[model samples]
Target: MSKVFDFSGVDDFCSGGFMHTNPKDSNLFFPLGRHVDVYFPRKRSHVSAPFVFSGEVKPQPSIEVLPDECLFEVFRRLSGGQERSVCASVSKRWLMLLSSIHRDEIFPAKGNLDPEEHDNTSISVKEDEAFKPKEKVEFVDSERVKSVNEEFEGIDSDGFLSRCLEGKKATDVRLASIAVGTGSRGGLGKLSIRGSSSTRGLTNLGLRAIGRGCPSLRYLSLWNLSSIGDEGLLEIASGARLLEKLDLCHCPAITDIGLIAMAMNCPNLMSVTIESCTNIGNESLKALGRYCPNLKCITVKNCALIGDQGIVSLFSSAGHVLSKAKFQALDISDVSLAVIGHYGSAMTDLELLDLQNVNDRGFWVMGKGQGLQKLKVLSITACGGVSDSGLEALGGGCPNLKLFGLRKNLLVSDTGIVKLARAAVSLESLQLEECHRITQCGVFHILANCGGKFKALALANCLGIRDINFLFPLTSICHSIRSLIIHNCPGFGDVGLAVLGRMCPKLTQVELSGLQGITDTGLLPLIRSLEAGLNKLNLSGSVNLTDNSVVAITKMHGETLELMNLDGCKYLTDITLSEIAQNCSVLTELDVSKCGITDSGIATLSGAEQLNLQIFSLAGCSFVSDMSLPYLGVLGKTLVGLNIRHCNGISSSSIDLLLEQLWRCDVLY
Candidate 1:
């Protein structure tokens, strides 16, 4: 018989040992210093300590953990990168739990589903299903997706629309009714139907279904829907009362009646984007002013029918509610410009694109208006009529303007640019593209005025940027310029670039494409000086560059280089690739298309074990073949896109294997 000893004291209890009365048996827990354990009567044996951690037998709570589903709900909220890098590294149990989660669960498959099932797949219909309209075309809305179906090619709008509008003329009406009947139970708030080869034009009937099904819809984006006329838009207005934001892009069928319908039905509509609708006129603007009392933002682009009168009507009616407006590719003249200046007083953001007629007089009128004071972002692109007088007016009128874009405006000269520069000294970003008339004098004036605060400056296709002296003042102006794009500027060579190299030590992106005069003499110093800060470098079409330039780049900017484009650099050889492989480890995108690199060069780079290279382009390399495929397969896990176009040496079978191995990668043949 086993002896039973009963004792209770503070010393025994506090000394990592205790005694408990077991209901099944009179088991006792004793601290023997070395092998403390509980005695079980049924088994007639001693049980080990409940918890043995780090050589200490500590009393532990039972492993009655929460459910896996409960834990998953907490961990799934992490961002994609966080879930993969941080959460998965904790333990095998955690790794398994995360791995068990279906990718579709993490990032739901969006877009229109196929008629056969409700599963989230990009493939909606087979070849036979393209002709059937009686079958319902299922559209499901998901949260922000990273990408859409690119393989849905070869399917045009005619075939897709045939399926959508098939079987019956009243199908759209039925779908709308169904949507409306579902109400808030469907939890539909945002719907984005972007263009796809298989996706057809959506008319009023389709919209009816959306309105009926998604009655609580707050945002709707119908892109490239050419069949959508005012009749369809009216259906949306009537059914979707809660709609606050609507984006109708490239929908030519919509007219002024549709805008009026929206104004009357959606009183809460705060933002509307109507692009490429040539039929919209002043009546729609007047209706919006009268009906949409709370309207705050509007973007009207490529609408030739709506001119100054339509804008005037809109401002006259909804001036108090207006804050942001963009007018692009319009048929507006000086008359419209004056009207905008007079009534657009409440606007904070304004963009004028491709305006053919409005000149300095319009700007002068705006200078005297109330809107100029509140304007913060003013983008004028391809406005040929606006010259020195207009720029001068803007300088004096818009005091708080932080962003100024003057692109494709040949009329803007040195005097105008200087005048504009002096006026907006607080400018943060100045983008001057294809402004051929602006010279070194204008550049100096800009640097002297706004250089202190300027963070981004792009000079593209500017024929007058030849003087090397223009580059000297950049360092004194601001030591840090985040982004600088200099393309098609034939005048500035090695001497000018040396000045830029010293001044732009903080350049993150530098595009020196099409600089015909630049050679190793100019590029090497600049690359070496800005090595640490440069993340993106574009030397495409710089034919004069040799292999030594690549060596300079790898030596200085290996760690920081994420995107490197050496397209059309005929002199770069296998030696360049060898050097890059040995030094650079984090290159995400490397474009060596049309370069004279062969299999030897590519094999070395792909063989590197540390590379996380995602995008690789060897489009015009004729020698790349099956031998290079194995090496590229090393980066299969990280690669997202691979362009092997015109690589005649590669067999179709090898390409198929690559596609199979790298299933997620977008391979271009």
Candidate 2:
């Protein structure tokens, strides 16, 4: 048993003897002193104590009886430094706690502390005295927090409420506001308050809080935040002087004012993403150029307000430092291209430039500059203004260009293609999709020049391509070509595909979608030749491929195969699918949508461990019923993406089991 003391009404509990509490039990407490008196729980009268020790007996004192130094240590651990200072008014114990907690706050130096003030310190000094002295301590400024917090209304109450509950007991301590103001003295390095959408108009408050608390912040991401504006941004700029990466994507409210403030304040700014900020125009871009001389990468997609002048300003300001620029889906017409060509000549270090939707005149202007020698990937899709002449200029200037996208450029013909093939000797991937005038003659030129290094070739909907003979020379030279896509080429038949398989022995992926003339006869030779590296084969809309082609492919490349797409092949039945499920050991993704697969095919796939399947797409396949759901559950553990959309036969029970079995499944309709 332990003695109990009551001092709840006692205002100050600073000086006292050593307190004691049972080592095993924290609840029983008593004080250690000759004048100590105990009060019974039922009565108010104090009783005298002899304080005699007995067997299996101990004394535990209340918090009021503990020594001031021990009490200060307890309070220091609880309140830290900032809260301890504010709570000091409650009692002497709190004052001691505040002093003890912040004793080592200042940086240590020799001959800094006053000798007269040294005796006033309650903390015992070490005898060795080798420790360096420090100067007087200073409190964190409140004015900086106030200036930044004013822009964010209604956010201060929650912050104050949280602080009030922390230190001492003061019911009347009605905090007016809590601001994390300016100065980079003791600030946070990185401030993140993501996924807090319910706190309306509080994002600015959050930003201000960070600026006040973390002055040395380097990286900040305000993604999907709509409440932040110019005032909050300016506060951050003035406070976080060492900021580097700033991501403000989806922040529609940010305009020229906020962007300019950021550019001017953050000198070490390296990467910035301003996607979907429609209000950002020329003036702000110029500010970015003038302030952030070390800017490297910038993404400003869908910024409709940005025109030729803004782009020119941006390039003129940061062209020398920019290494990557993405301006996708913008209305950058001929004027913008001219501006880029003139001012962008300074961007000699540029590697990737996505100028999608900039017309033919823009391409000509871009080609006129000699700075694009280091350019690698260039995409200029849907630029109706571009003609064959623009491509000729690009080929002549950008000799090191590798991946070139000329999709939807209607004027590109055999002559322009031949010119590009001869000049761009380093070309590895070329996209000529919807270039209706491009013929085999142009492709032959590419084969003769840069075909040996080509990796990916896309010629989708090229109407002039009649035979695969032009590809043979290229495939023969570049045996390393991996991905070959020739969709909607009506002139290509079995002969072309056979030649492709024989020449491109290292091809890993082949997309022959919408080739109506291609039958199993064309696929058989290719499948046999691609027994080594072929992993993905897209034969969608090739209606003529029946059980024979699938059987031959499964028997040949079953072990190494991963994904096989046979969508719209109506003739494929359960017999071929069962054979595939039994033989293909490495098959993970099998897309047989709109095929004539029945319950038998599902049953065949149910027990095969060699399938090791993850993504199973059976959209538009009406033959499968609820019977296949059981088998799906057995194989559901490894499934990641399952698309059974438009499968009318599946019921709610089957879906429930699917949801239970495949914990990581993403079911798409």
Q: Which one is best on TM-score?
A: 1
**Backbone clash numbers for all candidates listed:** 10, 15
Top-lDDT candidate index: 1
Q: Which residue segments of model 1 deviate by more than 4 Å?
A: 1-214, 220-235, 248-258, 275-279, 342-346, 467-475
Listed in order, each prediction's TM-score against the native is 0.68, 0.66
Estimate, for each residue in 367-412, the C-alpha lDDT of model 1 and write its tens digit.
6565566777888888888888888788778877778888888788
How far does residue 612 in candidate 1 sit from its true spot (Å)? Answer: 2.2
Q: Which tens-of-lDDT digit does each residue in 24-128 have in candidate 2?
A: 332254333544443324333344755453235455545666777776556534322223323433443333233333223323324544332233222222411
RMSD of each candidate relative to the true structure:
20.7, 12.6
lDDT of each: 0.68, 0.64
